[model samples]
Target: MISGLLTGLSLIIAIGAQNAYVLKIGLHKKYVFPVCTICFLGDFLLIWCGVFGIGAIIQKFPIFLDTFRYGGAAFLFVYGLLSLKNFFKSSGSLVAGNTVSLPSLSKVLLTCLGFTFLNPHVYLDTMILLGSIASAYGEPGKYFFSMGACLGSFLWFYSLGYG
Candidate 1:
């Protein structure tokens, strides 16, 4: 359990796009509760799936992974372009409401989902890698590891969202 807790913390502590988006929404105090809940639940689901050996099934089907990879790439490209356009249109100020309009809750939620689901790294890290590691501990240990990982995810997202 301690090992799992430490490993989970180490893995999720990194500041990635998902973390950044959570922090931004948190700072703005918009949809923080829902966003954080989504992130935590998403991580929990993925980690549990991993612990149950879904990673092996996914590995067996390379085509499924390929499809998602290409789709994720396209989605990321379009999102990047949109972000670039927004950046250019803005006056480049930290002030929230001066020249930039906050996005609608639905838009924000969709974007949050995109950031969460479209990133292949999330699956690789949480599912494949973490799952493999948890497997080394046997059945009961895997559950403990998964719980620790889930706790780590909840703690991290809540901290980022509400801190």
Candidate 2:
């Protein structure tokens, strides 16, 4: 459990797309709970699937991986364009208490989903890497490892969201 927790933290502590978006939303204090929940659940599901050896099944489907890779890249490109436009328009800063309009719930949720699922690195870290590590522990230890990973995810997201 301790090793799992440490491993999970080590993997997730780094800043990435998902963490950046979460921190942005959190700083703005909009949909923080739901956004954080989505992140936590997403991590939990991926880590659990990895620990259970689903990564092997996913590896068998190269076409599926390729499709997701291209699709995610396209989405990210568009999102970047929009963000760049917004930046040029002087929409808002990352500072708290800005009066910028909050995005609609559906839009926010969709964006959060995009950030969560569209990042291929999420799968690589949580599913492939973590899963491979957990496999070394066998059945019961794998479960504990997954639980620790999940806990680490929850702590990180909640802290990033609310702190």
Candidate 3:
């Protein structure tokens, strides 16, 4: 369980759409409850899909993963470029407006959801990665590992939302 917790934590800590959105919401403290709920539920669904063998099925499609890798990389690069552009354009020469806004709750929620669901890497990390790791354990170990994954999702999201 401890090992599982560590693995889950490490994965979730990495930059991703959900984490970015959670941090944005935390900074603005707007619609925090719903944002947290959506984030947690999204993680739960991904983790569950991973533990339940759905990940294995996904691995069969080599082309899909290849395509996803290129597309995801491009998206992240563009996002980074946009941030850099904003940073340069500002009079203070720094990026801002990273926080969530009360008026943009719906937009934020929808964007977060879309990013989470649309990104293939999300599945690659949570479902495929976690699934592969969990498969190494025996029955009891697998159960505990799954539990740890679930707990990690809740803990990370709750802390991120409130922090």
lDDT of 2 by residue, 1-163 (tens): 8788889999998987788888888888989999999999998998988888787687797776787688888888898898899899995687777777678989988899998888878888898899999999997898898888888999999999888
- Return the top candidate by lDDT: 2
- Candidate 1 — which residues are off by over 4 angstroms? 93-99
lDDT of 1 by residue, 29-123 (tens): 77899999888888888888888888668879988777767877888888779878978987675433344555898888888888787887778
Error of 1 at 101 (Å): 3.8
Q: List the residue pairs that clash in candidate 2.
A: none
lDDT of each: 0.82, 0.87, 0.73
Clashes of each: 0, 0, 0
Candidate 3 stretches greater than 4 Å from native: 91-103
Q: Which prediction has the highest TM-score against the true structure?
A: 2
| 2 against 3, candidate with superior TM-score | 2
Q: Residue 105, candidate 1: how far off, in angstroms? A: 1.9
Off by over 4 Å in 2: none
Question: Would you give me the overall lDDT of model 1?
Answer: 0.82
Comparing candidate 1 with candidate 2, which one achieves the higher TM-score?
2
